[model samples]
Target: MYTTVELVRGSSKLADEKAMSAADVEMYIKKAQARIDARLKKRYRVPLAEPVPDIIESIATDFAAGFAIEKYYSQRPGKEEPYLAEVLIKRAEADLAEVLEEHLLDGLPGVEFLPPPGPAPAVLARPAMQSTTPVRSEMTAALERW
Candidate 1:
């Protein structure tokens, strides 16, 4: 899994909320991991191996915490304006999308390897041009005539 239940609890108010059980939190965490994996599988190996990237863990924790909070809301609805859980989920999703879309995981473990950036292309100087005619002398003669 990208993140642990403890991590999910720590990142959000899951530990403070009494509505969700440890098992329920774990379930939500697992689902969040699966969702993260499904989206990242295109560029990284699902269930990412040990030493998972910090960003991945962060993303997973946000997703899990958001899910658990949503579950809590379902069980005990509240009038709290601006649901924080939805914000968490949206932020996590956007972060993950950016990682994939920008190829940000190129060198990270469990991700498809990418070649290092090459040096900047060489700049070629244009050849200097020279006039075949003796324009200086011609101009001098013209000025004299004028």
Candidate 2:
């Protein structure tokens, strides 16, 4: 039962971390887009220019790298920093998603909306623990008695 609780906690932390990473990526993309817009208006003197997709992708990659680091640090026993960061990430991602949707759909009509940030890919590979006795042995014995 304790192990189950720990697993649940770990899963929750993982979810939070992924969400935070997504938000950070979104923020970096937004700021980069703003800068690009400013530059185009002041220097290039263009009335309107779309932000480059490559810039957003680069920022997303950097955010993922940061998440990887957090995951690494979280492996230390009794450390909660990583878990806290994970929760913060979820809030950030939700906020960023709303902002992105508003900006992207400002002028477009009849366009389907983009999906918000989804689950993050598993970064750490956990080796399955091997035990001689089956975990469900008691349950199996009970069913046999029935």
Best candidate according to TM-score: 1
| Candidate 1, poorest ten consecutive residues by summed lDDT | 73-82
Worst 10 residues of 2 by lDDT: 1-10
TM-score of each: 0.68, 0.27
lDDT of 1 at 24: 85
Q: Any idea how many clashes model 2 has?
A: 4
Backbone clash pairs for candidate 2 read 16-86, 17-86, 19-89, 20-89
- For 3-122, candidate 2 gives per-residue lDDT tens digits of 122222333343454444545434433443454334333222222323423323333333333344355565677557566545544443554354355453344333233355567656
lDDT tens readout by residue for model 1, 1-146: 77887888876676764756778888888888888878876656567778888888889899988887777676555745128788889999999999889877778765654345667655535566777875567776889998
lDDT of the structure predicted as candidate 2: 0.41
